[model samples]
Target: MAFEMFPTVNKCESIGREKHTVVADMDGTLLIGRSSFPYFALIAFEAGGVLRLFFYVLASPMAALLYYFISESAGIQVLIFAAMAGMKLSSIESVARAVLPKFYAGDLHPETWRVFSSCGRRCVLTANPRVMVEPFLKEFLGADMILGTEIGSYKGRATGLVCKDGVLVGKKKADALKKAFGEEPPEIGLGDRQTDAPFMALCKEGYIVAQNPEVKAVTSEKLPKPIIFHDGRLVQKPTPLMALLIILWIPIGFPLACLRIAAGSLLPMSMVYHAFWALGVRVKVKGTPPPPVRSNSSGVLFICSHRTLLDPIFLSTALRRPIPAVTYSVSRLSEIISPIKTVRLSRDRATDASMIKKLLQQGDLAICPEGTTCREPFLLRFSALFAELTDELVPVAMVNRMSMFHGTTARGWKGMDPFYFFMNPSPAYEVTFLNKLPKELTCGSGNRSSHDVANYIQRVIAATLSYECTSFTRKDKYRALAGNDGTVVEKKHAHLKANKLMGC
Candidate 1:
């Protein structure tokens, strides 16, 4: 094939190419993966839920057969239909923006990136749907233009059909490039397959990306922008085998998850830790927990770095006692199932402060000031309210591991968070209690401002967990994932009372 004759991307000079424009193929050229199945599975699950994913998986064999025997476009069309047919366009876009980038960032080809990133203008040409690939390419990879197959949609729902130009393979890819660049061809073209050869032939220079399983992917740190927040249930990319395993496991896992949750909820606080272990949930506690306080004394405030909705429950498990936690936004179902007390924060500075102070006076309190769960090894900006509420602050670093499924989602129903988390086989939580803040360093002691104290505590927990701290807040997280500020609208009665208080 023509692609076999082209020089490998590794042979292309990647340095001193600021003035050059590079047109690259998406999957194997820019990213390490040669197949697009995992990504389609991701979109399938994220947009249409597990049933859609199962349907996609069932059709995978046909897609594979057609891919190898019939045509590449035929395989892709089958995937698009299985994954996206009848799904809302909005949901697909949200997944593209929030979920796909993290996975895509992880799969970046080091050699391809070296050449692609060196160019002044970058373009990506692929058979993947334009909506699916555009956001990640433009936002993360800084591509100047994207030329890809367009999905047919009616009334905001995908029809699972490609547009008239069809899947951008062979002559279609070359034709699209001609239409995009006019007489001025791109300086460099990178491709991984013979199908990509047509477009690669149009560029001034062409480099083939050969299949090499041993090549290491470009690390997340090397990306143009770090992915701080992402929302999806699947922890790892779902290849055909992985997808099959997941489908097979869900029936067994759900009941197991329900049993585990029941054990944690029904068992006594002291015994919950042992029950969790029996149920295949591992809770590892490190460092000394403060002794129980007297009834009359103000409670010790536990400042925790949030990992999931279960952070406080695990914190309570670590302490062998129930610690009432203040939450920014939690579903009613989550509150109902929670073993420890969960107090909702109103987001009002004075009201929340008073509520937390009252909780502290009642006994020990656990608060995650980051206000949201961050999946990465990073802490969001602390709220500072907890810092001002008490000097008896002990930073808690919380981390969780799930091999099969993530227990959290920004776009999905919040009630399912716990259930999804428990569904993971042998899920684990690590809770490390750091040294208590000295009285002199606290806002209550008049030695530091609220923000200063909060920042100090954030740093302390971050250092303990070996995580980087960022100024990204709950709003930032929601905006990236759900396209809104992470604020739950209050009930009518509560809204009226707040309005009356404000004289609105």
Candidate 2:
């Protein structure tokens, strides 16, 4: 029986026919939200590092032009495949096989897969190259037949050429269906895009699995609601504008940041609040109201969760006090321009400790023991030095969320990260201050090791953010990103990813 939204085709009378088949488009319909083809290159590039990915990413623009001016999306796909030419087919197959299990379990759409499995014969008619999806279609989907574009290969390597059949697109797709299932139309069909319309015309029962209800409203207004399915997944397709949008927010950032620093440093604390709020950075504070940062008191030490380079800046904005900060890697020049006093650590334990002790003696001081900017919720092991220095520990938990630009980074010139963060229309921060650690919790008479005090602070911050507590450290992340060995002679750079294309 056909899904009710679709008209029961005349072919229902022949339901028991040996080839009673249901066909679906691969990219958006049967598979997950995105097209299945281009990911083939990503799989291939796992063996080749950032350079290989960089080369493909560079060619994407020409591919985009071809999409608009010449053929449809098929042209862009061919360009992508062409770049993979000479790549070992085994490399492609290996990554696909390794990840297919997880992809099917996670990324594949749940609702559509059910409708797909309910059909008699599972045939995915797609413009994606057959070899790319064939392994999974056979191993995972139990596909009876695949109508897809074919790639030419020689001696276990891609040749970067589409076979003589050309891209399986538009009218070509409709003709291919007729060639296989005879001149008679299909009994059941499903598709997501207008490009899927040609073959849909041949279906006895056709359904549009639209992501946007408005699209279905305007296009299939007269069509019955149930047959016009909506699984509520965003359609993910390659777009030229993504790279452009990421960068448009960058140009004016530096100037605005200079103004932010100058204003925050010179103006009254209340005006400092207005200055950042004007730039659309809302700082939300919670928990009990603490005592004043500046007082007749001798000294105060602030221990905070490491989020971005601007953690202290955001903290400074929240507390209305520019506490001098001690850091491991930040340069002295960067600190000079900052609104707050910053102590750059020399990475020498004794020297750095002396500097921190002296700074604390002079006035209030702040430090992020995690030692690095971590974009993820999990944190690195906290340095125990902060715990050893002061019993008056002020645990500050801060997090920043941005839509247009991410402010945190592991590499590249992070000096501009705050500017990039402020570039967003509405950059936001959630800051929480736990009650100052009591004598027992703070490395006091119970004679707690600095390690114990550090772990306690880590737990408090992790619980506040609802982030997973992990033993992973900056060294682990550094090795992953830069292939850093124990010695820092010259860390080999990893393969450039799509996200890394825009500066960190």
Over 1-504, each residue of candidate 1 has an lDDT whose tens digit, in order, gives 477889999899978899999999999989999999999999998888888999999998999999999998999999999999999999999999878988898889999999999999999999999999998898778899999999999999999999999999888999999999999999999999889999999999999999899999998767775666788889999988999899999999999999998988889999999999988999999999899989989999998888889999999999999999989889999988899989999989999999998888899999888888888877777887777778889988888999998888888998998998999989999999888888889886776898788878877787788876666678878886764523212224323543343222
140: Cα error in model 1, Å: 0.4
For all predicted structures, in order, the TM-scores are: 0.94, 0.58
What's the CA RMSD of model 1 in angstroms? Answer: 6.7
Question: Number of the top candidate by TM-score?
Answer: 1
lDDT score, candidate 1, position 131: 95
What lDDT tens digits, residue by residue, belong to model 2 across residues 52-98? 54556677666666766888655646564645677777755554443
Candidate 2 residue 179 Cα shift, in angstroms, is 25
Model 2 CA lDDT for position 59: 70
- As a TM-score, model 2 comes out at 0.58
